[model samples]
Target: MKRFMLTWVLFILCAGTANLSLAQSTVYTPATDLTLVGKVLPTQQVYHRVDTADHPDMPPAVKRLLTNSAGLAVAFKTNSTTISAKWCTSPRTTLSNMTAIAYEGLDLYIKKDGRWQFAGVGRPNGDCTEYTLVRNMAEGEKECLLYLPLYDETTSLEIGVAAGATLQPLNDPFQKRILMYGSSILQGASASRPGMAYPARMSRAAGLNFLNLGLSGSAKMEKAVADMITTIPADAFVLDCVPNSSPDEIRERTAYLVNTIRQHHPKAPIIVIPSTVRENGAFDQEVGKRVQAQNEQIKQEVAKLQRSGVKDLYLLSYPRQLGEDHEGTVDGSHPNDLGFDRMLQQLQPQLLKILRKCDLAGR
Candidate 1:
């Protein structure tokens, strides 16, 4: 009896050791070695959509949000049976309306059938976290895109895989880069994860790389910010700034914003999308009037620009940007994932139509 008990204990220990050996952490490639997509500037900073050092004069809010990895992702190919990640993010007060995963988490997509599909998500723990993202996959080479946190600054990231699996960089799929400048919605305020942001979704679906430059509530289109935006040589420009701007600000700043970009781009198309009808406008008469006023004023400005020979300028709109049922928003202001999906349904085709005219439509 004593000999049998000792043998059973020894067997348990060996099994535990085998399990540990099966998932060792020896093969991690630092993110610096990978190709980072969805950035507005060429900087090696881990998840910066915009580089603050170059735009010292930008608003403090805009400067801080620049670090948010709204639309940034790392492209790589691996044949690992399991994909894992180790990453550290900045300390932040958890947002009340947003999910912890969406605020500061990693979203993974695997390419299959020539389309990117959501494979897994790296759920964040704290300032630093490590976890196996996906497992139980059949052995085969696969292309992968790992999206960084939407609202937090990622300090470091390392992709890990099973031992002996080959890991290599994948090419940036979207060839035409469009600079997406707007408010918190574009910065991905309430997306369930980073990839659900309208710009990120559009990139995967439309074949145009939309770099997120969302400034939260700070996309007021100041001339200083306009100058900074012009510095990035984007293939196209998208101005979704009206939601955060007042009717007066839109009237005063719209021409400056469009003209400054035109001075730099000359022919690169500029697509201006006015704010959606705030959901609250259904009841609040004053809110309804304000949104209408802003929309009408911006339309006039677009007409003036077109008359002045602003070629390839388009004013894109949808009757129900959120939805006909008015059920798409999270807080009657920002989009939930459903809200974003509904908006993308209309936005994707309208944008491609404008891009088609400029001979810059698809990848």
Candidate 2:
């Protein structure tokens, strides 16, 4: 009986050891050996959309589906321990479901050499697509990998988390925050990689934390959605929805979208953007003209509110000039890379003006 009991004990120990080994092999490799004693925590995260419905200025089915919270993330450590983790997702394609219309299989990238490089791809649920587990050092400052994609097409990608760092909060308390609400271009389509999108670029350039709420085709200023926007604390809010909606819808919802954010961020500045370049060549130029008209309407509304004593409302004027694809867009309606640049260039100064206000407001 004693021998049998001993044999059972040995078996149990061996089995446990084997199981642990297997588990260790399957998770993300730790980037550091720093003491990580605290619980793994979730930092700032946004839940917004990118839309392109009002842009009759847009041609057919082209759309970008970027999200505001799609920026950088870092992991923190509490003890000197090695952790193994892996990420999973459901569908690799963008055509998953309704929510996917906003966020699909986009991964975050790391910025290196003044350009963003692909880090790890985003996974949905337990369907982890095996990315090599990289190690990181968290010195409690919460530095994790930036989840943005490379904007410059020629940059090389990097993997592995850094050491002694914690994840950057989606909402930086110190830096000014900019909230971008727009269509798929803001949503990050065909940018060659994640984080390469225009909104992401703007975030990096302006040195501000970004909240991208770019739904692919869902920028209709629904009261419910607008109500959701009110919950976030933003230094400023941007509304760009010409690729998804019609003129009437644009006129109707633009005020509501701006006003909703304004209601919550009463003192926060609001900048409304006219639609970017569209397809259909010169024929589609009319869409740009209509967008200009819509801008006029929005401006008038702001003026009315200003008369009521409201303050700090502005507009971004996008030219009807041809996008990179003078024939108008790579995927029929959406702007190509060159188009994104044009849009970004036009937006930079306007964004700077608003950010300046953010600094003064101390958000």
Candidate 3:
């Protein structure tokens, strides 16, 4: 009798395993129907730069830095009940306090009625190549947008839908583009998810396209970088690189960066944002003073630009933009999801106003 009971348990376990395998075997269709927005070209896998020597406009150093696909996204409308991602990254880990999801995960959003809503996230596998973003989604057709990894440099990526699902490009009417240049925080540092980053949030809230050129601790407002920014045609520009620059650097380079971009885009709105107050500034006087000095220099440069008759120029400042409670950052330096939300709340309104101004100018 005991032997019979053991045999029955084994049979049940085997059947359960078979059922699980069957449940996991959903066929995926190639996501070729989606419109690859945000990128410069259909053949270009990287978003912000061209191959070295291929373009006469940007310096080679700037081109090399642009290889990191920080702000690229794919937009589509689909009737699939399931979604998947097959992607590979050059580096699986960023070696920071930030998680792999913030660096390499695929962030998915759905358009309902007229607004974009966060749908789900696709976590990377152990090798950082394969991910099943969402399986068995709700039925019916919906517009979808998938944001690529913010920090991780993707080597190859592809979206997948359930077999025989209806898929096409999303017909979004908002065409104004906002270009952002800044440091690691703008590059999506310690945010728990990609969509939680301020740029992504602002993009959805304002219904505008954004090109993020945030280099981790490297955005020094260099002339080469400024030249690269000029190559892109955008409706508005946001400069937030004070955290990565010294007071001296800010004083020296801020004016030049503004002037260079203005030379290329005379009428585009340029918004200068000072650095967010760092978390440790309260206890560390030196850090506090350094940040303050940088901010002061930025203000001086913006004032200088305005004095010189640079139109469509604006400045945004908040003493405690991230938050006063010190609960907004992952570390003492980089913003967490809460910090990003706080930033979005403060910045989105100004962005909307800028977009409206651009619309009027266009008309």
Write down the lDDT of every candidate, Cα atoms only.
Answer: 0.86, 0.50, 0.74
Any idea what lDDT model 3 has? 0.74
Model 3: what TM-score?
0.86
Global Cα lDDT for candidate 2: 0.50
C-alpha TM-scores of all predictions: 0.92, 0.61, 0.86
Candidate no. 1 TM-score = 0.92
Model 3 agreement with the true structure over 93-132: per-residue lDDT tens digits: 6647677777877888888788888888878765455566
Error of 2 at 224 (Å): 1.5
On the 0 to 100 scale, the lDDT of residue 31 in model 1 is 78
Per-residue lDDT of 134-232 in model 2, one digit per residue for the tens?
Answer: 334233322223342211111112223324423222233224556766666665654444455666666556555566666666766666566656666
| Candidate 1 residue-pair clash tally | 0
Which residue pairs clash in candidate 1? none
Off by over 4 Å in 2: 1-85, 95-127, 132-144, 148-174, 284-296, 299-308, 319-328, 360-363
